[model samples]
Target: MCANKKANDDSLIVAIRDLNTHGQGVGVIENDPSGDCQGMICFVDGALPGERISGTLRERKRNYLIVTLDQVLEPSLDRIDSDCRYFPECGSCRLRHLNYPAELAVKEKHVRDLLSRNGLLGHDSPVFKQIMGMKDPLHYRGKSIFPVTSDPAGSGLLIGQYRYGSHDLVDLHDCHIQSRPALALVNRIRELASRDQVTAYDERTHDGTLRHLLIRTGFSSQEIMVVFVVNDRQADEAITSWLPLLKDTIKPLGFALQSSWINDMDTRGNRILSSKYRHLDGSQTIEEIINGVTYRISPDSFFQVNPRQAAVLFDEVIRAAELQPGERVLDLYSGVGAISLQFASAGKELVPPLEVTGVDRVKQAVMDARANAKINELVNLSFIEADATEWLKDYEDNAENQPFDIIVVDPPRKGLDPKALDVLRESGTPEIIYVSCNPATLARDLALLSDVYGIESVQPIDMFPRTTHVETVVLMSRNG
Candidate 1:
C-alpha cells in the first residue's frame, strides 16, 4: 500500500547528497526531519552528489524510493564522458562515467566508510592504507562470458550482457574493458551459431540448445579456453559436429589458436557452468605462471581475472604475512592453492621450511590444487577437500592440528563465516591475512574477529578497474 502511494507522488527536485553501494546517486529532501517520503531520498542513475536533479520515481521499496533522472539541473565536477558506447545500459561497467582518479577516490571513501560504520576505523584502529590502482585500467579483464540469445525480432544471435535490470540480451561489437581477442572469439562464435542454425536458449520458454559462452584467457601465456554452455547432452554432439566448420570460419577470424574447448551443461540456474564438462579439443587445462609458480587452469577454474594486478595483490599478501621459515600456514577458501603454493614455494629460501595447508569446499578445485602443488614441485604444501569451517572444527578437536602460526583467507563475496571467525579466535593463530573482494563484508568480518585480532595493515587493490568493484587485503595480528 505504501509503495503504491509513493509511486503516485515521486516528483521531486532535490540535490544528491551521496552515492549508494551500487554507485547510484542518493538524494534526501531538505528540512524534512520525520519525512521519508516528501523528504525521502531520490536515487538517480546518472546523477552525482551535490548536483540538483529533477527526477520522478521509477521504483519504490519498503523504506526508500528509487528515482529516475528526468533532467539534471546542475552537474557535479566529478562527472566525465563515458568512453564505452553501451554505458549506463550494459550494466557491466558502472564507473565508466567517472574519471579513473575519481573512481579510485570514491572506492577508497567507500572502504573507509564501511570500516568506520562498522566501528573498525579510528586513529588507533586499523591504519587505512592507500589503494593500489592499475596503471592502465582498460582491457584488464581476462574473463568474459557472453549470453547467447535471439534478437528482439527473434531473428539472429544476440551476444552480450543483459540490459540493465532486464533479461533482454543486447549485442556488443566492441567491449573496451574485456580482452580484445576474447571479444573476437565471441563474435566468431555468434557468427558460427547463426550460420549453423544453432538454437539460442530462451529463458521464458526454457527451450533451445546453446545457452551461454564462457571464455578464459591466460594473461601471460596468451592461452584461451572456450566453454559452450548448452541445454542438454545433445548440444555436445551438435557442437562437435560443427567444430570443423567453425574451425574453418573462425580460422580467418583468429580463433583457431585457442588452447582448449569444453561443453558446459548448465541450462538451469545462473551458475557459470554445470559440474559436468565434456572436453572436446586440445588440453583441458592451460598453464599460467604467477609469482614464478605455474598453475594448471581448467575452464571452470577460479583463477584471478586480472593477472597483472593479481601479482601485485599477491605481493602485498606475502609482505603482510611477514612469514618466517618453519611457520605453519593455513589457507582457507584457497582456490587452486595460489596463496598456499606461493607461501610454500617462498619457504625454499627461508631458514626454516614453511608448512602450508589449503582447504576448500570445491572438490574439483582441490584436485586441481593438489595437481598444481605437484607440478610446481612445492612438496611442503598440501590441500584438503572440505569446508574451511568444518575442517577447522576437526582441527580444533584433534591435538595434532592445534594452532597455526599464520592463516590466510580468500572468501567469496559473502565474506568469512561467523563460526569460522570463532574458530580462528580460539585457534590462537597469531596472524591472519584476509584477502577480500567486498569491503562491506570485510568490515563485518573484522568486527567479528576484533575480540582476538588487531588490524596491522589494510591495503586496497584495484582488481576490477573499470567497474565499481575493488579488492582489499588486511593483515590482522592476535590482540594481546
Candidate 2:
C-alpha cells in the first residue's frame, strides 16, 4: 500500500509499529516512490501501537511526514476512553487514551528502546529494573499555568493551554491532572479579570496586558500561591484594584491563600516568568513537607509539580546513594537544594557528619537553598551559585574539593553538559547518582560513561502519570 500510495493520497493506511518520544506513532514506508519518501519514517498523531490507522499526510518534510489520524481501522485492546474532554487537542496528557497499566508499559518500553538504541543497555539487561508506577495518578499536579488570551467570538477572556504545536489557545473548563484548588483559583481570577475588563495578552501582535496566571498549591499544607504574569514593569491599574480582593476571597474555597505576586515580563517570546518580581501581599513563600523535611517554595523557584511522587523519587535517590559517615556529597543543578537537604538530613546522625554542597546557576535558587538550610537548621550543607559545568571543571582542578565520595547530578532535560560529562567521566568519584527526566539524553550520557563507570541499576519512576514524561534514577560506580 505504501508503494501504491501517492504523496497527496486521500487517505494512507498506516500500521503503527512503535511510538516516538512525543507519544506519536511511528511507521516507515517501504519502497515508496511517489515523491521520494521511500523508506522515510512517518509520525501519526492519535494512533497507538499495533493499530491500523487511516490518516492523511499533513506536512511532508524531507526526513519524515506528519500524518493526521482520520480513523482508527483497528484499535488496540488496551485503548480506553479518555476521561478528559480535551483529549488530543489539549495536549497536556499524551497517553490519556490508554489505560494506566498500558500507559506504564508504553513508557517502560520507550525508555528501554532509547537505552538499547544508544548501546547503554542490552535487550534483556538485569540492570534495567521494572518501572515504578503510581497507584492513583489523577489530579497529581500541584502547579499549573494558564495563558491568558481573549475569546475571538466573545468579549470574555480565554484561559488554558495552547493547541499542540500551535499558538492558538484552547479554553479549558477543567483539567484532569491539575489540583482542584488550583483550578478553582484560576476560575476565581478569570471571573474577576473578566469583570474588570482586564486585557489579555496577544502573542500575535504583542498587544494586551495579562499574559499568564500561575497557581501553585501545597499538598500537605493546603496553602496556595497566586502569581500574575503581566506585560508591564509596573503593576497594571486594573490588577492593582482587583488582585487584593483575591487575598480575602480564597479562604472560602477550602485553601488558604499563602501569597500573591506579580511578575513583570514584557518580552515578546513565550517565556512566562521574568527576573523582576514584586511581592504584593501575604507571606513570601509556602511550605511543603517531604520525607520529614520542610521545603519553602519561592515564587520563582523550580520545584517538582507532583509532591507525592517527589517523595518517592527522593526516597529512591537516598536508597541508591548508600552513604557512609563523614562522606562528602556534591549535588549539581540542585535547585533550592531539595536533594542536597535530604542528603544532609540523612547523615545528620552519622559520626563526623556527612557534608553536602549544592551548586546551581540561578542566583535566586541559591538564595532559597541557603534560606531553606537555615529554616531546617541543617548547617552541614552549603550552596554555591555557579554554572554546573564550570563548577565541575573547577572542582577537578581545586585540590581541596577533589575526590568527592558521592556525586549526585539532577541536570535539566538537555542532560549533562558535554564538558560536565567529560569532567564526570574523569572525576573518579566512588559513586555517582544521576536523576534524569529525559530518557534519550540519559541514555546518551550513560553510553559515554560506560567505560569509566559501571551502571548498577536504573529505576524509572512515574513522576508525571498520564503524560509521556518519566523520571529515572541511575546509580553508577567507578570502575577500578
Candidate 3:
C-alpha cells in the first residue's frame, strides 16, 4: 500500500535469490528511482529464492533495502501452509513458513556461506554431512520465556511472545513450538494470574508485578521448573497466596514440579531474571541426564534448551574429539562440566583414562560442575573457576601446570575473544574441538586459528529446528 510513496519508488519486483544469515530472503533490484535502489540488494521476510515477488520498501540503508513482500505471485515448491496460529508474527520460529527440508537447507547454506566467505572452506570444501533435524520438529522447545503484558482489549493480562523486532506481545495462550507441558503450564499460569489478579508489568509506566513466565522442562524425566519473573521484590500478596494454588492445580497433569521460584527483574531492558530471587516451593535445582551424566540444573544455569538435539550435538562433539587415555584435556567455558564429564566418562573404558580440567568464570556453574562430576563419580574430571583466556596464558607460563594435549571450547555466541584466540593459537595444542552456536563468530575465530590449525571436519547440527539458529562442531587439528 505504501509502495507508491515517493520514498519507496513504487515497488521492486525481483526473483527471490537466496536466504541470508537471519533466514530472510535476499534479492537484488537494478537501477531504480530510490537513491539506494541502484543495483541495491534487498532482503524480504517470508520470500523464498526462485520465487518472483513484489516487495514494497520499508527502509533503505547504504546498499540494501528492507522490503515487505507485497505479493508472492509465484511461490516456491517449499512453501507450505504453516500450522502455527502465529507463524511469521511470532519470532521464535523464523523458518516455519518454509517446508521442513527447505528450513534445513537454509541453515546449511547459512553455515557454509559464513565459512566460505571467511576463507575456511578453501579450494577443497570438506564433504560436510547433511544437517541433522528432528523427526517431529514441533513442540521441541524444552524451555520458554513468555512475556506478560496488559491485554490490548483491556480485560486481563495477555501473555505470549514479543513481536520479532519489538516488545509488542502477540497475545497467545499456547505456542506451537513449546513442549506439551510448557504450553499447558502457560495456560495454567495465565489462569492463576487472572483468578488471583496478579499484576502484569507495563514498560511505559514502569508499573505492575509479574513480568514473564519462565518455564523449563526435562525431556526424558518429564519434570518441570517454573519461575515467575516479577518487576520488583516488593512482596506481592498474589504471589505469596496463589503459588500454592498453582502447584495444587498442575499436580495432576503428570508433570512433577521439580522447582518453583520468584525472580525480580527490571521492567526496562526486558531483563529475564534478576539477582534477587526467592524459592517458592520445590528444590532449587532440576535434574537432566545427558549421556549417563546427571546435571543438577539451577534456575539461572545455561543448560541447552533442546535436550533431544543436545544429545545429538554432544554425540557429534564426542566423536569429533577422538580422545584417548592418559591425555590431558582442557574444557574452556565449561558450564556445569557437561562436556568435560562426558569425555572423562568415555575415557573410563581406556585403561589410562583422560585427565580433564574444566574452567568457567561463573563460580556457581563450577560448583554445579563439581556436583555433576560427583554424581557421575567421574574422578578424571576437575573443575576450576577462572577466566579461560587468562588461565591458558598462566598455564603457558607455569611449567608445573603444563600444556593440554587436547582442548574443547564451547564459547558463547560472541565466540572467542581476540586475546583468547591468541593464547589458543600459540598453545600448540595437538587437537581442538570447537562447538559454536553462531556461525559468523565461529568463522571469525577459525580465521585466527587457521595458521596453526586446519579445520578437519565441519558438522552443522540443527539444534533448534524451525528457527534460524544452528549449532556447529568442528575438529581442528594442528598442521605439520
Candidate 4:
C-alpha cells in the first residue's frame, strides 16, 4: 500500500497486517461507515504486523492522513527484541528486530515480486537463487558521515544522524551498524567538538562553524581518512589546532577540510573552501582484496559496501557467463576494476588467456582500474574512461574486432541508461550479465531488453541486510 493516502472525514482504528519496505506498518481500514467503498490505507511507525493500533488524523498537503500509533494489539512471531540501545532511533538498520533467516527470505521475496510485476519472470525462467546474508551484520559499514549541529537551547555542538522525518540532528554516541573503530572516532570527535567550543553549523542563522564530519576506513588495512566540513574558511585556526590533536588522538592516515558557505533565503549553496589536504606518509590509497585480486581505492571511487558478498556476486557472474578461454569480455560501468580484475585473474589460472576491456566515466576510477590491472600483472586487460553509451556507440561503428563474446554491466541504482540499452540491443553481444541494486529498475530494464535477449537466469544476492535493498545479477543470451 502507498504511504500517502487520501483521508476521509470519518477515521477508525486499524490493525497493522504487515511491514512495508520503509519500516512502516501497513493496514487496510475496515467497513467504511460513510458508505465509501474505498478502504483506508495507513502507515504507522513503531507498530508491528498482526498488531492493532489506533490512528490519529493529520493533514499533509491535499491529503488528510492518519499518522499516530496508539497501541500494539498483537505482535508477530517474527518480532524479536532489538539488541542495540538505539534500535529504531539510529535509522540505519530497520529490520534488526527480525531474525536473520527471515530477513533474507523477505528480501528475496521483494526481488521476485518486482521481477514478476515487470513480466521479466516466467515459469521456464531460471531458478532464483536464495538471498545471501552478510558475514556480520554489525560493524559491516566501512564508511559513515556525521553532520555537526548546535543545540538550540545550549552553546555546545552535537554530532550524529538526522532525526526521523526531519532535518534536526540527533547526537549518537554509538551506532551498531558502523565499524567499532568508526563509533569510537565519532565519540572522540564529539568530545573534542564540545571541548574546543567549536560552533556547529546552524542553517537558520548560518552562524555556526562546523558542518559535517566524514569518516572512511579500509577494512583490510585499517587505514582511515577523516574530513572536516565547515561553513567558512575563518575557522582555519580552530581546525589547524584541532587537526594535530585529532591526528594524535585518532591516528588517521589522512586529514582534510571542505568548506561551504550557507546563504540565507531558505535555499542551499556549496563552495569548497580548501582544495588542499594532508595525508600521513603522503599516500591516499586503500587496499581491497576481491576474489584474491588486490585493488587500490581512492577517495571518490565506487566500491561495493559489502565486500564479501560482492565476491560471491562476481563469482555468480563468472559462472553465468560460462567464460571460455581466450574469450573477449567487456565490463561496463566497471568502477575501480573490481569485477574486471577478478575475471582476468581467474582466466590466468585457466588453460587459455582472457581479454578484458573495462569502461567507466570517472577518469580517476579508470586510472585506478588500470593501476589495479598493472599491479595484478594482467597483460590482456585494458581500461578506458568514457561514457558507457558513447563508447558502445563508437564500438558498434568501428566493428574492428569480433563481436564481444560476453558483456557485463553493473549499473547504478537507476539501472542502465536508456541509450546504453539501445546500443546493447543493436550490438547483439552474444551473452549479457546485468547487475543491479534496485529490483524495480532491473525489472523495467529486463522487460525492455527481453525483446532481443532471452532471460537465462537470475541470482539475487543480499548485500544489504536490515534494509529493503537487494542486488541481482541476471544472465541473458541473444534470441535465435
Candidate 5:
C-alpha cells in the first residue's frame, strides 16, 4: 500500500512545453480520468520546453497549483552552457542558457502573441521585423552598479552583486556582461580596498563605510565615471590617499562620493550624507554618438543601455509617425531628447518648417534635452519638465494645442498613468507612437486606448538579446 501511494504521487509528473511572458515555464496536464476536466497550468522554474519533471502541489490564493522541475528529468535541445559564471545565481537573466538565435525567436514570438491576443493584430498579421543582432553581445553592457559588503571573515571589503534572490553579497572579480574596462576597474577597486583597509558597509549590521560602487562608461568616448557610495562621511586617510592611484589606474572622467546615514534597523531610510562630487579634467559628462549625432550624458541623465538597437527602435518610431517635414510634433517622456533631437536634426531637410516639443518629468533630462537643442542649433525645438498627465490635462483645456499632428509617448515600464491616458484620449492627438518595454502592461493599456484609438501597427524590437525582454513601438490613430 505504501509503495502504491508513492507511485500515485510520483505519477503527477508534467512536461513543460512553453514559456510564459514572465519567463516561467508552462505545461498542461495530459489526462483527467476522474472527469474533473480542468486544464492544468504549472509555473516551473529553471525548466524549458520539451522537459518533463515532477511537481509538488502548491496552494495559491484560491487555487491549487503544481510547479515542476524540482529536478530535471529531460532537457531541451535548445539549452546550451551559460557563458556567465553567475548564470543560475543571478536572477537578472534566466534565458542565458538558451541559444542566442532561439532566444531572439522566442522574444519575437512573445510580442506577436501579445499583440494578437489584444486584437491589435491578427496572428497572420505581419511579424514585426527582428532587430538586427548586436556586433558584440558579450561585454556589450557599458554600465555596472555593484553593492559593496564588508566581509566579516576577511579584513577588507568586497564589491559585487547580491547573491541569487538574496541580500547576501557575492564578490565578483570579473563580470562577463560588462565591458573589459569595467571589469578592470572592479578588480582595481577590490585591490585598492584591500590595500587601504577601507571597510565595506554591511546592510545587516548597519555598519562600515562603503555601500556601493557605480561605474558608467561611454564606450565610444572611453569616458568612465566611478561613484563610491558610503554610509558616512568619515575621512579614511588610506582611502583618500589612494584617490590619485585610482585616477592614475582608471583614467576616469569623474570620481564622486555618495554618503548616507542609516538610522532605522530597516536600513531603508539612509539619507545622503554628501552631495558633492569632483570632476576629472573639469568635466563631469560623457558623450555618446547615435546615428552620426552626438549627445552629452551626465551622471543622473537617462540613456538607452543598447545604443545600436536604440537607434533602430527610434527609426521604427519615426517611420510609424509618418512624419512630414513641416509638421509640428510633441515627444512625451523624452529622455535626454533622443527622439526629439532626431526629428529636429532632420526638420529642414524633410519638412520646410518643423517644430518639436519634448516633455519629461526629470529636470536633469529636460535640461540635457534643451542643451542638446542648443548644441545642434535647432531653433524650433523646446523641452519642458512637468508632470506629464498634468501637462496633458492643460493641453486638453487649451484650444490652440488641442489637436497635435503627432505625439510620441515612451512611458516607463508601468505604462501610462490612468489620468494621462484619459487626457491623451481627450486631446485628440492625430497620431501617437507608444513605446513600451512591458508587454502585459502594454496589452492592458492598448485595450483601454483601443476604444477611442485604432492601432495602426506594432513593431517589436529586441533590445536585450540574451533575455526574453523586448522593446515594442506601437502606432495608433484616432478612430474616424
Candidate 6:
C-alpha cells in the first residue's frame, strides 16, 4: 500500500506497535518517499497493536499526526468484532473492538510502560499486580449523561454521545456500558421533549430549552434519578409536567424513579451540568450501598460510575491503607464521602475508632457525604466542605489539628496539583493511598512523590471495561 501511494499522497500505511494514553494505536512513519512527514509519530483510531492499518491523514502536530483509520491491511489476532452498534462513532468505548483479555493486556502494558518511562516501574519498586477485570463488562456503567442537541434536519431532538473529538451527536438508542433504565429514561425524555416542542439547547445560538439529560442508577437499590439540564426557567414547568409520565414510563422498566431534578446550565461553555439545581420530584438524592456502607448520591456528586467495581476498588483502598485503631485518616477529594464512610465502617469496632475526615470542594457532595455519614451511623467520620489543597496547607500551618496517620487522595483526572504534592511531601504522613482514574497523571504525580514516598504496591482495577480508561490504587509509604 505504501509503495503504490504517491510521495505527496495523504494516505499512509503503518504498523501499530502500542496504544496511547487515549487508547489510540500509535505507530511511527518511517522511510517515507516524501521524507517531509517521515519519522513523525502517527496515532490511528480503531487500529490495534500488531496490526497494519492504512489511514487518511486527519491532523498533523509538531511531532505526531492523527489518522482516521481507513482500512486494517493486516488485522491483529487480538482484534475482535465490536458488539456495540456505535463502536467507532459514539467514541465512548475505544477498546470494544478488541477481545476482553487483549484489552486488559493492552491497558496493563500501557500502565507499565508509562510508569517505567516515569521511572516508577523497575527492580526494588512496588509490587505490580495483575489487572483486575470484570466477568461481565457490559452495562457496567451505573451513570450516563447523554448530550441533547437538535438534529441537522430540524425535525426532532437528538440525544446521545458526542462523536470522537467533535460536537456531532451520534443519536444513540442503546449503550453497552450504560444502565438500561437510564437510557430508556433519556429516550422517554426525548420523546416527551419532542412532543412538547422543548428544543434542544444549541451552543451556537444559545437558543433552546434542554441542553443535556443525565441519568444515574443505583445498582443495589435499583433506583434511578433523572436530571434535565436546560437553558431556560420555563423548562421547569414542561419538565415537571412530565414527572408522572416519566414515572409511568420507568416503573414498567423495573426501576424506580426515585428522583427528578432540573439543573439550570444557561452558560455558554462546554460544561454539562451546572451548580444550579431545582428539585422536581421524589427524593433529593438516591442511595447506593457499597460493602454495607450507604452513600447518598446527589445529582452532581462524583460517585463511581461502576458500582460493582467500585466495591472492589474501595476494598483495595481500605486494604492497602492498613487502617489501625485510633489512627486518623484524611480523605481528600472525598466526594460524598463514600471511601471515608467505608473507612469508618471498617474500623468502627476498634477500641478507639479511626478518626476519618472527608474533605471536598463541592457543597452538594459534602452535604451528601455528611448525610451519608450520619445515615450510616459512622460517628468517627466528619465531612468538611473545603478545597483539598487549601485544607492541607491550613493543616500544615495550624498544627493544632491532629496530623493524620494515613491520607487517601482521589483527585480528578488532572491528578494532584503542585501545592498538594508539596504538602504531602512535607506532611510526613506514614501511609498514602492514591486513587487515580488517569494513568498518565497518576504516573506523573507518583514520580513527583517518589523521593519521599516509595511506591508500595500498584493495583489496576478495570473500573471502566471495554474502554481505555483504568482505575488504579497505589499504596505509597514514607521513605526511610
Candidate that would win on TM-score: 3
Ranking by lDDT: 6, 2, 3, 1, 4, 5
Best by lDDT: 6
Model 4 agreement with the true structure over 1-480: per-residue lDDT tens digits: 213324544444666776677777777655334433235676777666676666554433233234566445566677788886766776677777777777777777777777887666852355676676777776666567687787777857778887666677777877766766666667776777777787777777777777776666666666555666676655556655665555455455342221111212212354422444434332566666777788776655677776656788888888888878889899999989989998898887666789899999988799989998998888888989999889988988886857789999999889888898999999868999998888888888999998899887878888777766778888889999
Tens-digit lDDT string for candidate 6 (1-480): 223344367667777899876779998764355555566688988888899877777777666788778888899999989888887888788888899999898887777777888567773344888889988887788788889899889888999998877889999889888888888887888898888888888889999888888889998998999898889986677888998888888787788999999898989998788789988889998989999988888888888899999999989999998878899999999988889999999999988888999989988788888888888988998988999999888887786766789999998889999999999999968899999988899999999999999888988899999878888899999999
Taking all chains together, the TM-score of candidate 6 against the true structure is: 0.93
Candidate 2 lDDT over 159-246, as tens digits, reads 8888877788888879888887777767777787788778888878888888998888898888888889998643366676765576
| lDDT tens digits, residue span 130-187, model 3 | 7788787877777788889877787778888988877788877666678877777777
How many backbone collisions does model 1 have? 1
Please identify model 6 stretches exceeding 4 Å from their true place.
Answer: 1-11, 30-39, 123-126, 234-237, 397-402
Worst 10 residues of 3 by lDDT: 1-10
TM-score of 2: 0.93
TM-score of each: 0.91, 0.93, 0.94, 0.86, 0.86, 0.93
Select the stronger candidate by lDDT from 1 and 2: 2
The per-candidate count of clashes, in order, stands at 1, 0, 0, 0, 3, 0
- Choose 2 or 3, whichever is better by TM-score: 3
Model 5 agreement with the true structure over 1-480: per-residue lDDT tens digits: 011122245444667778876566777644333323235665776777787765554432234244535566678888898878877776556787788777777777777777779676786675455545555667666556777777768767767777655877777776656666666777787888787677777655777777776676666666666666666555345555655665666555343222111211214444422344433332666677776567787766678876667778777877787778679888888879998998777664664667888988888899999887787777888898987788878887987754678888888889998988898888777888898998778888888888788887777787776667888888888999
lDDT values of the candidates?
0.79, 0.85, 0.82, 0.72, 0.70, 0.86
Tens-digit lDDT track for model 1 on 136-242? 88777777888888877767788898777787776988887887667777777777677777888776787887888887767677666778888765556566766
Off by over 4 Å in 4: 1-18, 31-38, 47-52, 59-67, 123-126, 234-282
lDDT winner between 3 and 6, please give it.
6
Please say which candidate is ahead in lDDT: 2 or 4. Answer: 2
Give the higher-TM-score candidate: 2 or 4: 2
